[model samples]
Target: MYSPNFYSFVDRAKSDENGFIEFHNAYVSSKMTNSDLYFVLNRYGLDEEQKDFHIKISPSKTIQPKDKQVGELLEQRLSFEKNIPKAITLNDNIKPNIKVNAIEYIPQEYNHNSFNSPSEHHLIESITLQAHYVLKDSHKKNIQGDEQSLLKESIQRHKHKTKWGYIVFDRDEDIEQTLKQLNKTQPLIYSKRFKELENIKGEIVNIPFKEEWENKQIRFFAYLWRANRDVGWNYEYTIEKLRMELNHLTESAYAIFAKEFIRIPQLREEYQKTIKQISNEILAIVDEEKDKSKKFELAKQYSKEAYLLRNQVLNDIRDKSSEFARALAKSEKPILPSFESLIARKMQQNNFMGKFENLSLEQKTKVYRDIIDSSKNTRKSVNNKMIYYKVFGRTFAIATIAYVSYDIYYSDDRLKTAREHTNIIGFGLLGSSVGMAMAVDTCDINPICYAGFALLGSLVGSSVGNLINNATDTILKKYGYE
Candidate 1:
């Protein structure tokens, strides 16, 4: 799913004398997973139709494209071949009589998770399905009048015609335009809207069994659509929230660390100013570099320098003032849950030294390194949990709210339900932002503290909204208003 986006084309060429359509400088990229390529190919009929062809994709020495092609195509072929680790051969003899329904064409990955359900990761991006419409028999056949052979032929050919259609349920805004285009060709139908396809007499044949199955499939698809939207919304929300909180935490910690720990009053003002100057220099380097990889490397280098400067400053402060050293040492206690296992090891080694002056320079260095490592580990763990909650937890909550709203507000009064849901969510978000702003200064290096405060504020805001809604309902009932 994280594969780099690149443009590739299948060039058509005639088969050689050996009945082989040999491609030059062409291969499936190793960067592309089998499921990835399968998803792309499945849309164009990988499992639905029969084909009399064999595909052989084997590794070979570097082969050039057509001699005259000088610009982009030549470059692309070279890039493609360079990235390809291995290639696979596909040979199939599909039966003409075999018919695969739209819902049956599931990729290999789905098998591991569920029969037809997509993985959470795939759902986060988009849910693309090759959907089909039920094109019913236009003319009803007289079964009693037809002979046995005629009946068989009519059954095979007259019941329905398979019309292959392409559909993409993209999570992007482009989906609106895509739906519009699809609507021009065939009216987009919702499963909940059409209870029975047979109601459209003359077009739909009365087949109760098939109709029931199709209804189930339709409901499943509708569920997938709802899940897809919920996942996308939660993913974006959590990522934005994480980024904002991280930035706030980093700035706060840096300000506190620089002003309190790094700066030495005894040193010259100019000298003190240069102690934390590398952070600014690293930002400048990042801004100057256009290439992402190079920028990352430069930032990495500066981070190492920053760490050494921190250690040097801590040592200097320790040697000058034991009082300041003790204070700084106390701050290194297990501030985060991630530090427990790490600090436990150190505690056993040093017998949990009470006095900072008693510990050697090596001990101090180890403690500082442990705290840094724990902070990094905490950040990673928190980010993953944040993603999980954003995808599943928030989605569940929203779905529940929506369902409750739907139940409370009858179909005739859906506008009220929509308004109430919007108001509640809006209030919660507004409260969250205000809470974050108020608590950012109090937040320490641990990100969990800030997240907790934000969650508390959101809960309070939602509760207030619910109470207001109940009060309004009571007033309305008291006045005999609908």
Candidate 2:
């Protein structure tokens, strides 16, 4: 007779709170279905124990007769005949209590074209059960009595709760034929088992089970299953999470640097203060150190940290500078001169040797040279041709207008002659507009340079046109048309 306590234990094991049933089902499927249990038992010297246990655990009359027959059929299908010659023989010690009312093993049906070509054989290779089982007193005693009790306990407690338990069978001509016969009679049961086994391997092993197996087998299985599951899930999750966090950090860094760009001089001053603090700390450490090796190590550490901080600050500055450039490109604002350039220009405006200045001539000259070099590099980096063409177009347009105005002022016949010249100048202006439009598409230049050059070109062209008109009028008055 089956023990009620054993059934209760199995119920608890299979309960939703603890997924013991799922785990045990997975264990049995992996070992029995794959028939790797024999090899595992042999390798770990549990062959005799496994054989004894297998006989004892065989489904009795207490289990449904149909269930027992199904279990037997699954076992037969999974058994390694070459390795275990006695696999087919029923052990006389353990009498089969359950009557075999009817036996059926069906393969799940699949659409051939869904996975492969219609001509290709689409074989249903495995069946799985989602089941719950209770631990027998003997099983619990075996687990507790084992030398590796901790490993046993961990496996029993943690294995197979969520998304656990699967059984797979190797395909054979006989098995396929049997499945075909079964499928004709009961399609629902066969389809259910097929769906249960599909893409289920590691999850089944994670479900907890009755700790009746040897300690070594339990440990090996538990460790292998956990490692496989972690590889599939945990490790990838960790790396992906870290990558996402790093991307977020990069965005935060940009935001901080953007704030610094708007208040650059203030940020530069703050950076100087940080550098001073670092230097002071290094000096204090150097003074306190007695041992040469220790001092060298400490100094090196300080220097490395300081260098890293400086590099971070520099990168922040670069990011902010790029942001500023982008903003200026869009705004077409007057390029505010660089801090050093502005200071130098102010000094030059006051005269290098001015009585009002505190800075020495040598200091002023050095500052001026640095500003000049910076300005030169900045200009070199800009697209000069684009700037030049933009300025030239605007200047030519203004010159066309001034020339027409001159024709009005100096014409012998006032309205008629002026109108005719105005028409000529209007054509020139239209040509200039087309040239400027073409120039705009030629390159991506700094917007500040574009605006500056355009304004400068117009002023210069207007001055030249005025000078030309005055000279023409003076010469014309000396001759005739005036």
Candidate 2 lDDT at 200 equals 35
Which pairs of residues collide in candidate 1? Answer: none
In terms of lDDT, the poorest run of 10 residues in model 1 is 224-233
> Please, what is the TM-score per model?
0.25, 0.17
lDDT of 2 by residue, 211-254 (tens): 23211111111121111111111111222222223212111112
Model 1 lDDT per residue over 344-368, tens place: 5555665667554465555544453
Query: Per-model C-alpha lDDT, please?
Result: 0.36, 0.35
Candidate 2 colliding pairs, count: 12
Identify the candidate with maximal TM-score. Answer: 1
lDDT of 1: 0.36
Question: How does candidate 2 fare on TM-score?
Answer: 0.17
